[model samples]
Target: MNRRTLIIVTAVVAVGLFAIGGLLYSPTSKEVAVTKPVSNEAPLVRPHSPVFGAKDAPVTIVEFFDPACEACRAFHPVVKKILSEFQGKVRVVLRYTAFHPPSEEAIRILEAARLQGKFEVVLERLLETQPRWAPHGRPADSAWSLLDGTGLDVERARRDAKLPGIVAVLNQDTADVKNVGVTGTPTFFVNGKPLLDFGAQQLLDLVEAEVASN
Candidate 1:
């Protein structure tokens, strides 16, 4: 081959290799792991209450969930069971990620309930009746029905739902989800480490080990 032709071919090959390397090594936004505190360094707890043991417990389980998610509803019973089994040994913090319309409304109601200091009671009732209330692709009315039985004054609950402070709390939760890089519902963090592909039992086991270590 002529010298110029050979040089041109080599240049083309070099460019092709560079393009391939870039595709292979470039870091995309989705590839990044969410950074969070390893343990006690986490910031102030949000307005919502943690499930399971006392606030001062040795082990903490933080869950990011969407209320209208069927998977989340399926996990509700197991979560309650975990709280009951662990009692005072662990604490479960639930952060709302309203990924859908119904879930958004449900979160608003839950936040409103918080204003009345009945958040836990309302949450339990919602979980217990989630199937009836949170059917797939349904509207927010079912959740409202469950809230009706929370013993919170209906007028106060409605008013609080629209309160500026409660809206701010909900927005904070959304920001937390973004900061944590959570892509879906029911994501869990044990002692601040991501629990990828782990089941509820595995999660509990990790919590127990952490408690034992501490």
Candidate 2:
């Protein structure tokens, strides 16, 4: 071959060898993709917390409520409305912050009802008759009567309510209440984000926004 042609041929061969080497040493296209870390949000539900909705729902709303608080009663229907609207998209986790005089007893009562698999019914009945049971000052003794037909087995509940497990649940919730800076009943959180401003409309809007984003 002529000198110039030989040099050109050598250069082409060298380039081809380099290209093949690069392909062999470099990572495959599928293996070279950047990977992002998985997000792990703080847990919103506790073992003792009461849950409403699908167990593995995308959105969680944690509510610190006082059973004796009239505002809690008022907001109960609103929360139900929001849940109904969202259906399976959201779940509510109820935590106790028993500020009222009878609120602790109410919590104990609910805990007892939970043991009997009657948590929902007793909760509904308690809220429905909160005024009568958890009135101003000392709770009226008449409150016990309201639980008669609630499938609560009031006597059993009364005994179980004082047990260590229920007491521990109440104590832990109280501590969390302080840690979370819950000043009053019906305080709400959506997806570990606190409700900065308190209002029914504000809660609904926040929930709606979370639902849309998720």
Candidate 3:
């Protein structure tokens, strides 16, 4: 090849090599940000949520509970005993995890009772009568009939159950249930720590650990 041709070929090859190097090592102008899906699982406790035991208790047991769950019914007394034992050291924040036909209606009834300052009594009554009213696949309307004259203004509660506030509460709790990975009723979270293995004793142990830590 002629000298000029040789020089031109060398220049082109050098330019190609530089371009390849630039591609290999240059900082990219276009930033591809791969964002991961963030968890929306906030605190299980909300302002409108149902709380039992001392309001100022340092430790909080957040239970993702379904009113229709027979297991939840059984755990009621055990939870009560734990609260009695913990007393001022812990409180429970109940979030609805309505996994059955009667669960949502039962929550609505309980909230209606809350509106009428009868939450505790109505909750007790419903838990006590859950077998009759919350049996598997039970229609919600039949359960509503049972709530009548419980000092809840049952007719009014049936109406109020459709109210925006109660609905929003239920919807939010349902979303939280999925977000927090709750697959069953009576799922417990002690101060944001999930009960990895579920049992009455596990719950008590977690609560005691949290209470002691606080």
Candidate 4:
């Protein structure tokens, strides 16, 4: 080969190796810091608090979820299991991504439930019964049915769902997802670092590692 060709080949090889090394070593970098801006919107009412974990918890897991997404449905149990295992050790923040119209309604219902101080009960019911109600089309009927079981008056729940303030909270969550560059359902963030694996064990491992280091 000519001297120029050899030089070009060497540079290309070096660049390729650097790219591979960066990918392999990237995870060891320090956690990214996320600064959430203060919003004038009213606080959401819900169980376990909207904050990802105990304010004192060492690790935080932020999850962006879509109510009608099948993958989200599948992820709920995994999240529940993790929470049960790590209870107060890790903080988990759940944000609605609203990728579908039904998700908007679902977010509204959740916000309304928060107003009633029954948000956790309502959220669990929705996640648990998603398979029976969430199908090919809009799940408005199913959503209504689930709310009915919450023992909070159905008319009151509907009214709360339509409130402008509740809708604003949903919008705020949607904005959060966009801000974080989350493009899909059930994306998890450990200490503000996005976990692409989506597997329960992988996610737990990341959280555990973060906690151990602290």
Q: Pick the candidate with the highest TM-score.
A: 2
Clashes of each: 0, 0, 0, 5
Residue 92 CA displacement from its true place in model 1, Å: 0.8
Could you tell me every candidate's TM-score relative to the true structure?
A: 0.74, 0.77, 0.76, 0.71
**Superior by TM-score: candidate 2 or candidate 4:** 2
Question: At residue 103, what lDDT does model 3 achieve?
Answer: 86
Clashing pairs in 4: 45-114, 52-91, 52-92, 52-93, 53-91
Candidate lDDT (C-alpha), each: 0.65, 0.72, 0.71, 0.63
> Judged by TM-score relative to the true structure, which candidate is superior, 2 or 3?
2
- Any runs in candidate 4 off by more than 4 Å, and if so which? 1-49, 137-140
lDDT of 3 by residue, 45-150 (tens): 7788889999999988887788887666656666776788899999999999898877888899888889999898888888778878866654433667666556
RMSD (CA, Å), candidate 1 to true, equals 15.5
What TM-score does structure 1 among the candidates reach? 0.74
**Superposed model 2: Cα runs more than 4 Å off:** 1-44, 137-139
Compared with the true structure, what per-residue lDDT tens digits does model 2 show for residues 1-214? Answer: 7543443344344334444542111111011111221133323457778999877888888888888876677567667767877899999999998888888888888889999999999999998898788767654766567886776788888899889999899888888776565666677788877776555556778888899999
What's the ranking of the predictions by TM-score, best on top?
2, 3, 1, 4
Residue 48 alpha-carbon offset, candidate 4, angstroms: 12
* Model 1 lDDT per residue over 91-113, tens place: 88888888866777788888787
**Number of clashes in model 2?**
0
User: After best superposition, candidate 2 residue 109: deviation in angstroms?
Assistant: 0.5
